[model samples]
Target: MPEPEDSATLYAELLDSARRLSFDLRDCQTGTDDADRYGMTPEWSPLYGTPTWIRMSEPERRRLTRREVTHFLGVAIWLEIALQIVLLRRNHSADPTRPDVKFLFNECADENLHSLMFVGAIEQLGERHSPLDRVMILMGWVFRTFAWEEVAYGIVLAGEEVFDVMQRDWSIDDRVAPAVRRSSHVHVVEESRHMSFARQKMRDRLRGVSRVRRYVSAVLIAFGAHIIAKGLINKGVYRGLGLDWQVARTEIGRNEHHRMMFRRATAPLVEFLDREGLLNGLARSIYRKSNLL
Candidate 1:
């Protein structure tokens, strides 16, 4: 744990960094001739190395990967929009003069730009926005409306960290579409600052909190993580690929390779949550069910 003064200093420094970056959505290059390439790394695909995956033709595999990337980008756009709402609500009640509050506004702006970037990528891929199911829509509404402090920041960090891990790969992988790579690179660069701010906020909010409150917050955060992890890939993706949706879902459920990838992506977040005492028994169980443990 960092001292309060040190945390404050680090937060200020992060604010300075955010100001210096000032990334604009317009700078992202989405006009690339990458229609025939994969939109995500093949190994990262949910069905990678499975019998179903092995049976896929090269064109089919490329189509699946492209739809999967569209699903990911759509989910990111939804999460960003929800997070912008949460940040705006927090800023509305916070002291505007505080550096942290200023960072919140900066974060909201970044999220807005990120959403645009995602939308642009999806458009470039010739895909429309993928909407979440009603259940996830309701869960997102509850979370963005009522979640606060550690819980809010925890959820924010979980979403950003998981995406950051995957995007780090997408941004540099030569096999992925150029537009997807470019948008992912932009997201990764700007989200680093947001993740730092989220960590600082979570630590600050958790300090001196009671055990019972921490326990409850742990469950809530874990539940939020579960929702986020599950929401990334939509069922419509299989339908879009002209496959049986039920079979695809079952295969995805049994995919140890995808599970391993998910666990690896979430390792840093799990470690940080454990260190912060937010990985209680119930939280651990939820994370396990979500394949995020």
Candidate 2:
């Protein structure tokens, strides 16, 4: 935990960073050679090293990558929209003059821009994917409606951290499409500020909170993480690629490599949650079941 003075200084720095940054969607336009490139890092693909993956032809693999990336973008779009609503709710009673409230508004604007970028990326890929299932949609409404304080910020941090780790790889990998790389690079740069703001808010909110409330927040956050990890790739992706969806699901379930990647991506979040006393047994179980531990 930061001292009061240190925390205030950090908040000022984060707000300044947010105010200084801007991203233009036009800058992420696809290039001529981008069509021939992968949409994300090949290693991050859920089935990357599986026997089925090894048997896939180049075109099949490329199509799978496109679908997977689009799926990720779609999920990101959903999360960003939810986050915007959550921020707006937070801002409803907040003083606009405060630096924290100002940062929240800035983050909402950033999230709106990010959603547009994700939509454009999907359009560029030209892949048709189904929206998230009804259950997840309902869950999202519940979260954005009722989640507050540490719970809300913890969910935001989880999504941003997971995507940040993956996008960092996609942004620098030469094999990824230029548009994907550019959009990812932009997201990584902007979301770093959002993540920091969320961490600071979570710490502030959790300070001197009750044990029961903390435990409840921890479980809710874990469930939120589960929803995010589970929703990233749609089941329709495998079927779209002309593979057996059932088999692909089974393989993904047992794919230690993909599980390891998930664990690696979420390592920082897990560590932070633990330090904040939000990593109780129930939370750990949920994270483990979701392949996020």
Candidate 3:
């Protein structure tokens, strides 16, 4: 692919975005004594509107929400670790004088802080790991080592964009816990810049790339997105709430409301990827199975 047109200008814009959007992690504090409350709206809950949800007592639902939110935060940490590794690998040899390199380093710093925040949130809510966590970590290692530049960045972009949608929602809803809302607000504000950078990077890397690579990237990105979406709500969450794990998972999968939420959250990303020729037939099928199409 050809070099970024006027890299200096692109660098300047990214640097300015980083500067203007940075947030201090220390500012994410809750004044309420019951700060460990549920982190999102009941409507945003995974099993919301399901028959199981209707049958669940209020306390059961609230406990599930808290645990599910913690699992989601754990997912954030998982994604951030992969993202930081790929980003650092991508730009490690970049010219320090370039604005893009500086911006990338800044992003790594932001992600580091974000990871710490997520860990704190998870600890506060009680950490719960998915059964797939170990496998996902191995996948992250493979991705950082072998995935094509555009594909790696595309994967990163997919996670950030999808999570940004949820965080944007959580940040504004008054029903969410204050500390959780603050974290979501910070993430939405900072990830907007990361998303911009990742999109442009994907565009640059895709320029003049071979068709086979594009097709492979499309499938891989979709597959990665599938894992992410499924792993967001762990079975442990249901077990913790005294529900049958398989039944809860099945109900969540079949829940039209929950499926619609995924579709809506991923719509912008789907549009952008399709416009860029990264959402091919195979990718669309994969997204459909994940309820993101």
TM-score of each: 0.95, 0.94, 0.92
Reference-based lDDT, each prediction: 0.84, 0.85, 0.79
Instruction: At residue 285, give the lDDT of candidate 2.
Output: 100
Question: Which candidate order results from sorting by lDDT in descending order?
Answer: 2, 1, 3
lDDT of 2 by residue, 92-177 (tens): 88677677777777888888888888877877877776668677889899998999878888987898889999999999999887
User: How well does candidate 1 score on lDDT at residue 192?
Assistant: 87
Segments in model 1 whose C-alpha atoms lie over 4 Å from true places: 1-4, 27-33
**Model 1 TM-score, all chains together:** 0.95
lDDT of 3 by residue, 123-198 (tens): 5555364455665767777887887777777877777877888888888887676667778988998888888888
**Model 3 pairs whose backbones collide:** none
| Rank order (by TM-score, best first) | 1, 2, 3
Model 1: per-residue Cα lDDT over 134-195, one tens digit each: 77899989988898878888887888888899999998999888888888888898888888
Q: What does candidate 1 score in Cα RMSD to the true structure?
A: 2.2
Tally clashing residue pairs in candidate 1: 0
Candidate 2: clashing pairs of residues = none
Best by lDDT: 2
